[model samples]
Target: MTVDIEPSRAIPAHSWRRWVGLTGLLLAEAMNLLDATITTVAAPVIRADVHGSASSLQWIAATYTLPFAIALIPGGRLGDIHGRRRILLISLAGFLASSTVCAVAPSMAVLLPARAVQGVCAGLLIPQTIGLIKAMFDGAALGRALSLIGPVMGLTAVAGPVLGGVLTSADIAGLSWRVVFLANLPLGLAVLGSIRFLPEDRADRKPSIDVSGALIATAVAAALLVPAIDATIPPWARLALVAVGLIGAAGLAVHMRKTRARGRDPIVEPSLFRDRGFPAALLSSVLYFAVSTGLVFVVVLYVQEGLGASVLVASLTVLPFSLGLAVASLLAGQVLLARTGPKLMLVGVGLLGLGCAGGVVAANLAPAANLAPVPSLSPWLPVSLGLAGIGGGLVTVPFFTAALARVRPHETGSAAGLLNSVQQLGGTAGVAGLGAVYLHHTGTPGGALAIVFGTCLAIALVLAVSATAMLSSPKDVGQP
Candidate 1:
């Protein structure tokens, strides 16, 4: 539920305390971003140290994102029912604790559970950041605060891998890959200390939790994800899981209908589906993120395992992509979005598709080339990644603006939350599906990379075409 903060509840516009509180919220967001990106850079080192199997490595990433995606909608409702400040503080503390467990975990068995816990805490805490910002500032101040989010996110995207590489390569106190998880401790504490500046606020009328609906949704996601990621599962079992996911989806539809009939809000608003454009936007989002995120996973693995690059080199190799994305995002948000709207997103998709095509060429050309230095890596690879990153930047900001352009005010909160959830879910599916494909061809790393890039290229083309639905959406009524 969206907590519409009454103007009276907002901290005074001129107050310094509100700015301090915004710092804390941004730090919390950085912590989440850091953990998510940092792990990929360290995953190979972690697997080697723990003697983990390929499936275990995939689980390390998947466990966190899947649970995080499932928890997001419920997490927002939690903030509305409980005070946002209270829930945010509780969840932040939980995230730190889970990170500690992850840092010290001796095996994938222990680490996977810890990662899942961390994801849940992250999901619970993240939604509150926006809600609290709304409570703390309004008008121009709100716009300024919201504007800071994109830059902070862009900077974090660039920094996370570099920091992870430094920590892993430094082998600080012999912690090695564990240092990536351990690094969150000091940062989280700083954020926790600053939380006192935030004002407490909750919904005037508490919303009821949809426990069954949450469970069914979780089950559906798990049913679909597990079969895709786990190679050990027998063919019959995999098919059964797919069937279960389909059934669960049908059941969720019926359950949501009943909940709305009872005059209670469901985990997802059924009414939002009435718009043809919304579902198309969702599918486009899922496909775009799946390709983008899955490619990152594949590239990191390819450079390290295929080319025998050091952890630091692998991280640096991915740097240009992040830099391209960062620069493009700023331009798109401040300038291009207002002028081109959905057409800008289509252009972004086309670039990403071209990037993927380039990746396939690069993989086939330099499959066995020495990649110890960032400069020595195939030129096509970095150029491809940079192009993909630019495309990602263009799509990221406008997708939300266009998707929610037509949403009703009351449905805005649910629509935004679901969008966030699916993006995470898309990442999870990409890692599972694309990671599985790569794993199957691990013996031929170059061929594997080519195949993954080809797959991403196909998905990107489909996403570009499908995303035209955004064009059909009416311009946002609230825009100037």
Candidate 2:
């Protein structure tokens, strides 16, 4: 499973065309990121308009992410076989079509299915960005391009909620929340128009698809994700699903080894795990994202439900965090990372832990809600979140850069897919685990928030310790 760029079609790193192509890839990635959270603020409005059950509302969000996560490995393999440019274009087209359907959907039935299609397309599209970026850029150019990804991600996290609220409130064309889906159209079309600039690259030799391995992998992802997303399921059932996922993971590993033994390409190469840094990077990603995602979830709930703030105000409160993230990402990528190496990640973890401690203090200091129309949040809350975001920015790009550093050129697509899959799983786990902790102490909102932040701080400490041990290995140090 080695990819070779078509010599005639190869775009040079110095060419302006490559930058144009990179823009298209980044936009596509942003669409995927935005959709993941954009619907959160608008979910209530959507449910009311479509006459959807509470369960259906949950399904609306779950359907997109679950399929996206499940299809990632196979999607990356498809790019390896059929060429990244072609797959990206096809997937982008599908995403546009499905998003249109979502905008026009008159019922939950139509909307949920359309959202599922959008997720599948996003899965197929995202890996190609990483694949194409690696294919197109090298040296300092690669670092610069990769640096931009963290900022875009951080900004979009803020944009999703704020944009969703604004669109829904604006009630464009009297469509209300449907406008959120409609918003993807212009961005999608702009990227679509840049198709000609993208380089075509694929495997040197076509390989048979590992049908058994793909199915097993999808099943394992579903088993794990379904439980995490749908809290309505009984505790015993969720545990059973987790057990099934673990067993399936074991079976999938065996199947991949057997498939590779028979001289066929498995969905993921077994040899990738032999890279000690790759596994350590993956572990760090899981820990980092779990805390980050969980912290966001808890903060949003606390601001709105606990503090009795309006949705708009709640969304606005997160703005400082995103701004801090954007600033820190640029600093790390442009200046700090090239000189500091893995040591920078430790600094990030320490800052994040300190921010979490601030969050605990802020939560304890929150004023009790009164009958006033506008509720007041503690000043320290935004400051703490911003500090945490800065830490997140510091780690995000370096983590991706480090994970792929030791990977062979041929393994970029698969490695990118696996890294992304771990991220999604980590986020889901964080939401389920931390959300439960918050819910348990809902009667005491301040106390619940304190507990959540304390938990995040604890996780940050553990991640710092693990990262120290991981980076101490000679193989893992100063690679990028």
Candidate 3:
């Protein structure tokens, strides 16, 4: 039987359907990003309400990201094999159901698992966002559609903490921290309804799923992640877990090579890394995301538990950072990105290091009493975070554009999936790894924060040095 595998015509740029579909996609994108960081501001509240252990707090965030990172490649491949619209709808339904579970969860025990399911659903939905863009538009039209995503992403990141704080503090219907997830129900339904407006595209030649590669990759990620979750664990035991993780990584490399040799598609295209610049770009993406997530998670705790800031106040304290990120990301994507991709990233990374150093210094300057109220330190706190945010925009905006610069049309889904998955993985690792450090030093919040922020600063500087030497020129990234 013949299947409806391709669109008859590109959707017109001015058509109502096109805008509606774009709105749906953007809403979905916003919701996903919002959920990612919204919990940050509410995390302390959630911990108090649930009476959860410090580790549970970390799990609440890390659990969502781990599955998300692991599932993205397969999620993208599924969209290619089936249809973008079909997979997107399925994922959204799962997300809504999972959100409902999260909203009603009576304890941390139930909530963590529900959040994992939500992350998986997010993984499934996110890749289709980019894949649909590729399927719907081409040439300059494609560039225009894609350009809008950066600003939207920045806004969502800026808005997520504020929204979370408002919802949690307002305690809508007296649901408290649960309102964050409950709020998504309406938006989820709206996106589901608008799915009809999105263009549907499927691969003409369906490829076999790389089941073994996926499983092996999961093993690799898990071997490191599971052990890192608990700071109380013995260092010797954690080292063993790291060894197992290394073995799994080696196994994944071997299996992918075998798959390629057998002329079968692997979850990750080994050929993609053959480009010297692509691998460096991918590593830089990982470092950038890890630093961002880790810093946010730690800062939320420091602000609320250490500085005694209310949820709203804590969220507002971080607002300037988001504002800086939004402005810088828009500028980078629009102007600096085309002129000096690597150079701009270097500047961004350098700023990130300096910003992080400033935060570390601010943490040190704060009175170690652990009972100080909001506005504890100088204006330097937010300023430093804002500088870091600008660096974030500079690094990320150009990174995505540069990494996918040379990707072929047929490889679009795979490339987007791999890149996005790495980003999620970086976030997952950051929360898990740095959260451990934060928890281990909880008795002294300032000291813990100083250590974590210091680590971030070091990583940023290292990446800046590496990117300066390794990343390609702006022309190389922008060329077809």
Candidate 2 wrongly placed segments (more than 4 Å): 11-20, 44-60, 105-110, 131-151, 199-201, 368-373, 408-410, 440-442, 474-480
Winning candidate number (TM-score): 1
How far in Å is the alpha carbon of 160 misplaced in model 1? 2.6
- How far residue 289's Cα lies from its native spot in candidate 2, in Å, is 1.4
Candidate 1: worst 10 consecutive residues by lDDT?
471-480
Q: Give a tens-digit lDDT track for model 2, residues 396-437.
A: 757776677677775765677788878876765676567667
Q: Which predicted model would earn the best lDDT?
A: 1
Give candidate 2's error at residue 199 in angstroms. 4.9
**Per-residue C-alpha lDDT of model 3 across residues 330-440, encoded as one tens digit per residue:** 888778878875468788888899999998888777666445455465467888899999988888777776677776554555667777888888887788878878877
Compose the digit string of candidate 1's lDDT tens values, residues 108-226: 88999999999999999888999999899888988999889878877887787778888998999989999899888999998988888998988777788889999999999999999
Q: How far is candidate 1 from the true structure (C-alpha RMSD, Å)?
A: 2.0
Off by over 4 Å in 3: 1-14, 370-375, 406-412, 472-480
Global lDDT of each model?
A: 0.86, 0.79, 0.80
TM-score of 1: 0.96
Tell me each candidate's TM-score: 0.96, 0.88, 0.93
